[model samples]
Target: MTLNRRQAIAATAALFAAARAATPRGAFAQSPTTPEVRKAVLGYIALTDAAPLIIAKEKGIFAKYGLPDVEVSKQASWGATRDNIVLGGERGGIDGAHILSPLPYLIHTGRVTQNNQPVPMVLLARLNTNGQAISVAEKHKPLGARLDASPLRRAMNRESKFAMTFRGGTHDLWIRYWLAAGGIDPDGDVQTIVVPPPQMVANMKVNTMDAFCVGEPWNDQLVNQRIGYSALVTGELWRDHPEKALGMRADWVERHPRATEALTAAVIEAQRWCDADANKPEMCSIIGRRAWFNVPVPDILPRSQGNIDYGDGRRVENFPLRMKFWRDHASYPFPSHDLWFLTEDIRWGVLPSNTDAKALIAQVNREGIWRAAAERAGVPASEMPSGPSRGRETFFDGKVFDPEDPAAYLASLTIKKLAGA
Candidate 1:
């Protein structure tokens, strides 16, 4: 469910032009009004959590602010999402789109497919966090029950197939990392494939894919349909992990300063509105409608409202850190988050051993851009984060993560990395 869709849209629509205009007349600290952003193009994965963008668009947020012609397109993959912004270079055309957190970093460090080409990307704000989950079908319930048992070794030796949206981002990385971290070789343990988000459930039903990692409402849909049960919530692996961000080319930030700030301010407004529990039902309706995820409202309802139904009887309501849209200064883009991805890249051998990887991590993330946006949005200036954003967010369980000491964390784990530190 989403909060205040209409109000947020109207507020956003009015802000861009008003921000540029009224402030010029000493309306705000005698600073000049920012120039209006004419238009924007955003890439999205067509899921429920993308409600903010969909609602803002449907309610005319972009148009309200005089960016009436904002273009929202459905992108094919996370790789495409990055390419359109990074390697597609500085598009003097559209603003940006829904980018996964680790993607821009990977692109910058030449870690994944888009390596070598430096893409200057900054997070406008965090759109949604922690909407993703891994699901195994009802028939696989026995497998799901055994998921956390037996150290996952039995599953690995059985020649099972694991599926995900793509090879580059979180789903792939986590699947590989979890397997390797737990002493299973991803190559020999399980066969994997790239199945689009919409097809995850269908594939599961038909037995085409065994266990799949994907975003909601698909996971919820799989559960609601009794096709699958939850195995591992991402939080089970890494808690309070930053997921998606609104990405723009750094050149875009430099070219249209006012427009970027306006966009940032608008997203923050939308996030605050969406975060409220009261707003979720309506938000879900707006996003679950055909133009968005197109799933029924009920499927999106529980999850968006922080209710977790992992098929059968595993149901949890209001998980403490379950998919925060507006908590933890939820919008701040911390550098340590970037560093951790670099560390993961190094761990996986995706990034070369000798690259000044830390320097590269610093350069690509839009730390400066996010800080300025938070201030303009009236969030505490001191609230802005720096360095690695990963931290010890205690879960409903007693465990905690200190990204500060991943090596120790990794070392202490009973599982071993295939290639050792």
Candidate 2:
């Protein structure tokens, strides 16, 4: 007699537990060649961008690399995820994390939302690029974008409000930059507040926030719910922009050197799996399932499969770099990424004025670790250097960012950083 799905799931969970116990310490369950060496925990929120880690775990990339006991906990938010690692919620302290691109800077300088004691962290690899955007309420439709060249000045006069997760986030940074570029002051012109991504649409429906910036599916969620429209995609803001990364404490890397290399190998392979068009359907189910993403499968499948519903009578398929994670030297963890975030922190006054930006970045980034991982994971090692890198990223205004000369980039800006130099 065949059992039902629930019984099958229970049986699978039991098998996993039994296999785990039966295996000797440091022994991988199935792959005989790769013995289990160690286990590590990572924290991530439920967003499409977290796919690489999720897929990697589901696909047994972790087991392939000898990490039989790996656990990927879906935390509620970025702040909670960060705090979990900093406060040592993970076993034997957190080894690494799936975090924002600017997080390493925030941890180092103690700026932005975390204007406290510095939490030391480092970059291990880049997860993906161009996966976030700004969505505006439909009520503000005829006024162009309130975020464009200071739309808030006139809108605020009309009492419009904006929303994002909180201070020290990608949304806050992008909104501030967009507003300042549009000749508006981020802090003064528009009323901005914090709301969790999951509740963004509900809040907007209740007329709480006029606009919000969040990662995909949520932005897509807003559009689907008819509450908001896309003002900009991160790709439009900065074509192929870097968004998230695999982060860790500098001390954690120092403690377990080999584990870092293996961990990266598994993740890189997982990233490749997610990128494969054939695997998308399976990936969607993995992300949407209760054990993982826990989002509705209907909401999870389309975007995860690259068919996005833009909500405003626009259905876009195959948007170029529609979150091209782990593509074309994406996992290198470039020094330029660090510099850009550091500059933003200074520009936004998240840190005290005149923090040694480059110096602190160098200390946190385990260049040696990244180099080893890249070589092992088949990423081009030559592209990443020991010093500052000169890289140009395309953005919305059809401009390119040359990290070697951020001052020129800043000067060319029509908008200004609120934490001005």
Candidate 3:
């Protein structure tokens, strides 16, 4: 008889218990490597994408790998997450985080750090893909700006505020892409503001923002409070687009290579658990608790299971583009996806045109680490992606981004604030 995913996971858990019993005091269960340290601190923002790290902690997956002192601290904002990451765990900050995918690249390059001081960092794995949406304030409900944002073009101006969590993060990129596709200039057509994920709904409630882009459950919360309605999910902009990541301070990872692998293994296992259909409700409940997100489970569970309530008279069940935590190699950090993000950053003048994206990607992206951790996590060989490069990706507006030719992709875009312009 073929064992299902849950049963296989159960068997893996049994092996972990047996291995722990047989191993010496310092060694990790189900693996030959022993961690150099037993403790590490990680930070997270209160978004559904951060579920993997939370689950890893709540399920004791970290302790299973000999790191019993892993701490998943809550961060007030992405900027706070970056500042703390720069401080490092030894300095009372954190060692790693459930961070924006491009943030590690930006922080590693010193593009967003204090005084442009480069903080070396490493990208271990992608936490999830999709599950983010662009929301319109209820005032714009009559505009009917669905997937196509053209309807709001006339209403938008420099005075109109559009908020995202960070200047160069995934939320910024998604909102920019959506606006640009609709023939609205993101750089000049409106004012783009930065608001924390949890504050999105409250800001919209006070009429401070015309529209915003963020991960759940804020978007859902806004809809629930009847403050705003979703115009489009980020997946609608680009299906299965890369989002948050497991990023660590490079020095920390270097000092504790085995510990890094073990931490990654734990997160990988958690991602697998989060993706299972049977476990989403429990996962949401765990993360939504007062100590974690302080959010209602209803705000999180529906989207986690692929049900999208657009709150604009467009509700869909089992939407194909709902977030993927582990399915389709979502846990693997693909270098090609990073290239697109870098290219988009370049288009918006976040990174210089002369920036060597490939060199930086090679230095920062650690897919090799992901492979080792997945193997240790007991991920089936069939589930492992054949290789990097998810290939050419098409957007909802009919634009194609070929990862191999980033310049060509940039050249195709009509609205852009290219670096040095």
Candidate 4:
């Protein structure tokens, strides 16, 4: 009963092994695949949804699956993440990144980088879904600001600027969708600029931006700091909307297929762990460490636990559709979602009207790789959806986006900066 540290560790390991053996097949046991390379450097931003990668690195899931040297380092900003990932692991940056869902497509298509030279990146898995928000500064609340941009529109002038992490990224799209739905043209009605997520609250404090759309802690932090109010949660826009992704260079994935599989399996395991309500408190504590998010546990834990304080006299004690790391097939990179991102980029004139969306999705989405990793992890086949599409997704506005008819979806949009429009 009074064993030394080593003996206690051994006993715990034995128990873990026994549990894995007794569990149903595909319940996230260690995979048989051995990685070709042991060392990998990955990138993350300071957001709660970065949980899967952080959990993988912290929980020794990487080492359990033969990727002991996987490093999950924090990046200064999403732009830095893009640039460093482009630099690759050999150049002292990163091999891959926990990236914005649309970023892999943007990188592959040469939209976000210098010289417009495409980077052939492959999406390994989606990291999380939902749990992002658009917050309006306190100044706009006096103008009766709410989810609908109507009051905010009355207060807007040419000088009003909105902030999002990246111009063509997820936050941008969310804010644009929200504003456009409320009869505000994100492009023509106001100026929009880029501000990193961590700096969103700081920027709002200085009156640099009227509003911003970003991932957790920052939006929650703003409400804590008394500078802004949450206008809407992104999940309310579209439940279980795909958010971040785990992406690596196509060359890297090609050179080390086994390594990629190992990495995916480890991350999938981590996602499942993070999604468990029981593990949320520990997950928050770990990610809140200064080396990771550099935010307090108080700020981080509330949102992770689905306790949202909108900081505008509105609160949801048990908000449905909070950040999901694994549930609802969140890890699977649905090609249909990829198509939606592409079409939205085209709608905003970020991609050409003539771009072949289907061909590009095939080139970038590595769903097959994800499936292989799932099988290796012993994920039951029943959990995996039968097709590449999640089918028609309906949004808060009651608009349906049929992946099969993205062109029709695009044509139906009232506010668009479509190419040649």
Estimate TM-scores for all models. Answer: 0.80, 0.83, 0.93, 0.91
- Candidate 2 residue 157 Cα shift, in angstroms, is 4.1
Q: Write the per-residue lDDT of candidate 3 for residues 1-421, one digit (tens) a residue.
A: 9999999999999999998888786544335587888899999999999999999999999999989999999999999999999999999999999999999999999999999999999999999999999999998999999888999987888899999999889999999988988989988989899999999999898899999999999998889888889999988888898999999999999998999999999999999999999998999999999999999999999988888888889898988889999998788999999999999999999999998999999999999999999999998899999988999999998899898899899999999997772
Cα TM-score of candidate 2: 0.83
Candidate 4: tens digits of C-alpha lDDT, residues 160-225: 898999978999999999888888899899988999999999999999999999999899999999
Q: Candidate 3 — which pairs collide?
A: none
Please give the TM-score that candidate 4 achieves against the real structure.
0.91
Residue 137, candidate 4: alpha-carbon lDDT: 93
- Candidate 1, residues 1-421, lDDT tens digits: the string is 5549898898788898777785556345323435355566777886665666776677766664445666777776665675666534335433578766667666554445433666566556667667778777576576544234234455445467778776556676666655655556666566768887787888888888767888788888888888878776666666666677777776767787777776666666667678888888888888877766778999888877778887757778887646777776666666666556555555555555454545775566666666665576677645555444645544322334356665554344343233322
Best by lDDT: 3
Ranking by lDDT: 3, 4, 2, 1
Model 2 residue pairs with clashes: 28-36, 112-350, 149-182, 150-182, 180-415, 181-415
Worst 10 residues of 3 by lDDT: 25-34
Q: Against the true structure, what is every candidate's RMSD?
A: 10.1, 10.2, 8.9, 9.0
Clashes of each: 16, 6, 0, 2
Query: Ten-residue segment with the worst summed lDDT in candidate 1?
Result: 412-421
Best by TM-score: 3
lDDT of each: 0.66, 0.70, 0.93, 0.90
Tens-digit per-residue lDDT, 1-421, candidate 2: 8999999999999999999898886465344234334677887777777888988787788877777777888777677766776765344445567787777677655553344777677777788877777888888766667325455456664355777775666777777767666666666666767777667778888987777887766877777667778777766677666778888776666666677778877887788777777877787778878887666667666665556665555677877757766665556677787777666666666654566667877777665666666566665555445444636765665556678786666567654444533
